[model samples]
Target: MEHPLGVQPQMGLFEGGADVAAAMRTRGLGALACLPDEALLNIMHELAPADLARLACSSRALWAFANHDELWKGFCLDQLEGRWDFQGCWQDTYLLGKQAKGFQPGSRKMRRAAGLQSDLLYTPWLCATCAIDPSWLEVENVDRRSGLSVAEFREQYEIPNKPVILTDVVTKWPAMKKWSRPYLKKAFKGGMTPACLPNCVVRRFDKTFCETAPQLAKDYTVPEVFSDDLFKLLCEARPDWRWLIAGPYKSGSGWHKDPNSTSAWNGVVSGRKKWILYPPHITPPGVRPSCDGADVASPVSIMEWFMSFYEHKASTRCESVGYTPAECILKEGEIMFVPRNWWHIVLNLDECVAVTQNFVSEVTLPHVLSHLRSRSPALVSGCAKEARSGLYDRFVKALKEHRPELLERVAAEEAAKKKRAQEQHKLAGLFKGPEDACPGVNLANGSSAANGSSANGASKPEASGSAAAAQNGTSAGGGFSFGFKL
Candidate 1:
């Protein structure tokens, strides 16, 4: 029903202006205390951020409910659209004060000394001569014929949040075949430089590597390799990868998670690389130690932390406590599988040709969608004070009721699967090498062969070809594969 102001009563205030304000001060506490927990949450949800902050300050009971992480999480998810940049937040909230304390009158050397140093420990070895244009990269829509049907591929390969080798595409590009270590060094020596910020490039130590190469350049930009048509197609076909080619001397992209709520795959064709992975679920406790403890004072990026521990002489002691991070080296023709939501840092060991794509595959869409839906209330409420308070309360209730079981199940399943895989691998080692020496397989010539053949015949072949095609009949080649049994 419409209220006197022509708005629905539920959407409008029914009480008088002064009375409502007074009631908020006097009865608000009682209302918060007396309301059933769920209803109280619902009411808080109807309030705005200012009102929520006010409620938080009113009393210990309100404060407890207001400051509950569930409330802030929901507030963040809803209002911020899950795009809270930790670095940006740190800059605004903490770095300003830190920088101010160190400020002094003009001295270029001192100013340079005080500036934030690159915290990246492991840098990707890139061809030093190439230039990269950041503007050349754009998000793309999916194409139907690019190996896997977009939807089907997204289901099997993308959603499961595992990396896959994209064959045939870009393999014929000049960089894939020609951009080698020598070529990169020569280009850099000739004075090639990157055309834009945030572009990738290779750094070389010696002029000899540069003298032996062709297509020498000081730097390259995206405009040279990535055409508008190519960029548009990539953006359309694989909008998630955020595709960009590295310029000479630019390390493989710095360590960071893909922004689209999932993990990503970086497929290299001409170069070798190293990857350091930190399971997204793992969180280090206590204050993170600063790098060098004297010059660098801020918390280290997770990548710097892992690399420092990896390269340090005291590595054994770090590993003994299980603080040493997991690292993988991937070479050309090999695919590195990054699990969903894992934080990974990559270094290209040489001038490399690679395609990096982010995907939301079948296994991961539910989680991604749930994350998206959870942010809806924030958008619906705007940045109002009362509505925000209400949203926070609702979030706390949902956390109490829904999230714990899922977290526990995920943890248990991961533990069990790891244990089982280890056991199976150990058992399989006993039967390694020629079957002729395996007692079970060499029982008798005819008997062993006959029995083995029968056993092998009884089972199915390991599933091959595109995972998407295996699940559905659709193929990346725009054909279908069907099986017929008589």
Candidate 2:
């Protein structure tokens, strides 16, 4: 059709244009800029730190708005869990937080006290370490060839409290085939959802506040042996203990223990990782306890510090200390155990997708219980309160309902221990009596009736053997083993 104005619509053109214009009005800059400053900021509050950075670069107005300290302050409190003046620059503070998870220093002295060299610390020394000595660390690897059984796992790894990478454990999980960087990026909101990148070594995308990878809960399930997690039972209210960790190279956790002394298992669906573990007895060099003697803080990334130490081991002071660290190259379709209280560092070797859960099992129940009782009973999210006493009692009841035999066995063992302890106490006291010490001694008055008149008008005899020895000019020996005349 032709129009007099020479702007005639093509077939369905006017209708399509109306739809497109309406969509733009709802989604495009018109929609964004028309929003009030407060509403715009409220929308910006929903953005992740990385997205916020990108938004600032989008335009001058957004740059000014995103740079507001008030916005960053709220971000610090929400994302970082606390607020600190990073010299009145919330962006620096926010970026510092993204770099170092759980870093909030109120003062320079606080940073120093935390063993942090500076408020902002990141170094890429892992690549160098892998090049120089890839297998320098000493973590144990259990391949399919090892033929490890449940019994062997319990006795050697769980009971003895050690970490091991089991290659055959998760070979059948659907995630191994389905999860990939490209696939996930496409399926899960254009791969821009800032994952808990191990490169940053911080937990990312809290499901409590954000949605998750649609395929996570389906493709992966807890490994068979580790499915009986009591920590999860206690922390039934908290779903954050389990994490779907996905990130690019050089991203993983820092040198830290799993919260509340819970043991954990990590299964790699795809990609490889460098896992380093330190036993509870040996504190990794440069790891220091905070002021409370409870929490620990690190100055440098664990990998960097350990790498420097490994490179300088020949003439360095660490040679005198002589600590062996456990390291492993965890590959795809493999699972690893991180024992309770073990300090560990995980660095992704490549684009990685993994699942991990902090757990307490029958083996670690007692330790987890002890950890819980030591902390404040008020249930705060993510702290090991799930391992506490009152919560553990509830867990025990639940276990009794589902797995009564297991509870019965534990009860029987505890009863037997108590019986043995009581028997030992009686046996220890059996030989102790008044006659065993001083014969015929009076309790009411400190008088030996052996050589004095008793209350009943009877005289007890003194030691005649000693009296005879003295009369025979042989002094009764008391102090010295060798007889010497003084």
lDDT of 1: 0.37
Question: Highest TM-score among the candidates is held by which one?
Answer: 2
Tens digits of per-residue lDDT for model 1, 1-486: 111111111112453353433343344356444555456666776766557767766653454344333344455445543233222121222223234356333321210111111111112111112333232112122121235555554555444333444444444345555556455434545343222111222222222222333342212222211121111222222232334334232355444444334345554555665565533332233223232111212223333333344344123212123333445555564444454544455555555555444444334433433333334443222234345334434433443464545434534555676677677656645654464553334333322231233222442111222334323533211011111100
Error of 2 at 140 (Å): 6.5
Candidate 1, position 353, lDDT: 50
lDDT of 2 by residue, 157-252 (tens): 776566777777688787777765555655565444434433332335334212455555677777666766765544355325777777656556
Clashes of 1: 57
Per-model TM against the reference: 0.32, 0.54
lDDT of 1 at 389: 36
Model 1: what TM-score? 0.32
